[model samples]
Target: MLIVHVAVTVLLGIGAFFLLVGSIGLLRFPDFYTRLHATGKCDTLGGGLIILGAMIYHLFQYPETLLVSAKLAFLIFFVFIANPTATHAIMKAAYKTGVKPWRLGEERR
Candidate 1:
């Protein structure tokens, strides 16, 4: 039980850290595509970790809530699928519209 608690804490902390990194990347990256790449990957992992942590905690605290746990599991699966798909769709649209990639030495405001 103690070990499980510790693991949940660690997972939640790591998840928060990754989420912070994703947000930073989203804000600091020079271009839309780069930002999307950073947030798409990092945010996915971050969210997964956080959800995993929550599920673990819930599992320990309320083992009877099988329905809730299953819902969380489904949420995890949905996020894993949807985030990257959405990113890809946005990138595809941007490319089709001829949005130029950012180049070195280009001034962007």
Candidate 2:
């Protein structure tokens, strides 16, 4: 049980780190497309890991309660489906609107 708790805590910490990185990337990245790449990939992974940690904690601490477990499961499922779809939609819209990428060789204006 102690090990399980520690593991979950570590996972949550890692997720938080990823979330912070994503937020910083969103703010610091030069272009919309780059920001999207960071937020979409890093934030999604962060959220997923956080949710997984929560689910694991719940499952271990309340083994007899199905309600919490069920809710956590639903959360995982919803995030998994919604995050990528939302990212894809945003990227597609950006592409459609001709939001160009920042070329590596080009100097920042």
Off by over 4 Å in 1: none
For TM-score, the strongest prediction is 1
Query: Candidate 1: lDDT of 89?
Result: 97
In terms of lDDT, which candidate is strongest?
A: 1
lDDT of 1 by residue, 1-109 (tens): 9999999999999999999999999889899888898999999999999999999989999998888889999999999999999999999999999989998888652
Q: Which runs in model 2 stand beyond 4 Å of their true positions?
A: 107-109
Q: Model 2, 12-84: lDDT tens per residue?
A: 9999999999999999888888888899888878998999999899889988997988898788788878988
Report lDDT (Cα) of residue 56, candidate 2: 93
Clash count, candidate 2: 0
TM-score of each: 0.94, 0.89
